[model samples]
Target: MAIQPDSAPSELAVAEALKALGPPGLLTGCRRIRGGDEQFLLPAERDSMATRDRKARAASGAGRRIVHELLRRLRCEDVAVLRGPLGSPMWPPGIVGSIAHDEELAVAAVAMRSPSVRSVGVDVEPMLPLPPDLRAVVITSHDRLGNLDQGIGGRLLFAAKEAVYKASFPLDGRMLEFDDISVDLKSGEAATSSGRRLLVRCTARPRILALAYTP
Candidate 1:
């Protein structure tokens, strides 16, 4: 969710946005997260990882905490969000979720532990110009390149495609590059490879946020 003019980015705002989606089992949250120790990790999560680096540990801690907090609110039992072979989150049985973290912000969205929602994804990124080296690979000629002159379009496109990939991956289990999905920034929607369409809703305040939900 986008931050309100009166406030900074926060969990309340994101929760409100998820509620507005009107899905019975959706729970969402965002945090200005920091790294911590093994205490933050569930036994299963701590044991499965191969890395012992502090920064990696901290990022994992923050993501798990945000997820647990939302489940706590929903009164659901806490379960570890393990790492899948492809590096995507392996949500517990009966749940569909997505998580993304940048240097300073971590955001997560989970469809209430049920079979109804097949997948859910949320991504947040700084509204900066796309780095030069990544331009050709991510931004296609079909996109409205004119927005690049103004500076926010490329980042939005990258973020939207990321959100779409996360939402679609569980079904297809295929990795997607930015060029794989085409987005209409003006409409906040993307064309999916499987002939189904995924809606990409975006909000930009301190950063750009895109959330995708698959049917």
Candidate 2:
């Protein structure tokens, strides 16, 4: 279930979110990076924003800054933020990572000591009602099995696909469609028919979150 923005925030909330992250061992010496909203206001981010887009840009920039600073604290230097071939954010060499942000929340995962961790992708989307019309395009016929009537189920499917796209691009350098990956809406999980498994998680409220890692 997704956490409602209206609810009171607490340490338990953070822990609950982390718990949904699946096995920490899968991450192997991985660390969680947390940052407040202020970190997104860097000059570079500000410069890229349109005058009317300042608010949204600032929020996003602060989230990225928070994650970047957390990386620095982990001793990741020469931190260059580049764009991948698909235009997703790229990390410096020797780093595998995933990032998620929604409203006031942003979180990132980094593997500091894992040599085998190669491709990584993370995505965060708010828990809310999705348009009914687009569901067909995003949710394939295969995904319609098992409780497709629920709105939360649909959101999870959408989020899993987004995460798969993020994680797969670095490995295949190709754009993937919702149909390319099959999602189990009931479990809030996804897997590529080729054998890649992504752990999909969601809060009861409506947010869809996922992370994919390739060794």
Candidate 3:
């Protein structure tokens, strides 16, 4: 069943859920884009024991509604959203988009008329320390030894790479590794091995965040 905006969880619960996801810095400046006139109703109740399930469900539903509204605003009819073979969300015949959700937060980015916009992906992880081994999986040898310098910055780098991979998958139709992209921690930007630019920017302090729309 779809989730409904009317069922939105409390702000406190949403905040707590985002915190549990880690990387609080990512939440900085995250804004919700409304779907304007195209909002739709989603089922409010679902089976779940998680403390933040309701909040997360509500946020995801709101995100989906906003995407539909945005498409409508852009005069994009013929909208069809489906799951790709790899389970990535797919959009209508002439539209392209990406949707992401973590705990109580959900975000979506849609582009009209052409696949020329290529890839657009967003991810948000709470601000918290990560296990060394998992951290290693996210940062490349060069990044660990170079600009990233192995710390909180390294974690953000990892998150940025994850977002990049999410944004790029639809364009290339393949899975990508952290090493497949070069990220400049100082610059907050990522580029494909082939020099395709992927811009990543963070907002807020002690950040609760959103990373989106990689080129």
Best by lDDT: 1
**lDDT, candidates in the order shown:** 0.68, 0.55, 0.52
Q: Write the per-residue lDDT of candidate 3 for residues 1-215, one digit (tens) a residue.
A: 11123333433343333333322222211224333311332222122112244454455445556555556656775354544556576666656666665554455556653323555566655555445887667666555324433555656666677777776776666677778876665566677765567666543234434354443
RMSD, model 1, all Cα superposed? 3.9
Off by over 4 Å in 2: 1-16, 25-52, 113-117, 185-189, 193-197
lDDT of 2 by residue, 73-92 (tens): 56775365543444566666
lDDT tens digits, residues 94-138, model 1? 677888877766677876545556677778886577786776677
Give the 10-residue window scoring lowest on summed lDDT in candidate 3.
22-31
Clashing pairs in 2: 1-203, 1-204, 2-203, 2-204, 2-205, 39-62, 40-61, 40-62, 127-206, 127-207
Q: How accurate is candidate 3 locally (lDDT)?
A: 0.52
TM-score-better candidate, 1 vs 2:
1
TM-score of each: 0.81, 0.70, 0.63
User: Residue 108's C-alpha lDDT in candidate 1?
Assistant: 79
Backbone clashes in model 1, listed as residue pairs: 25-112
Q: lDDT: which is higher, 1 or 2?
A: 1
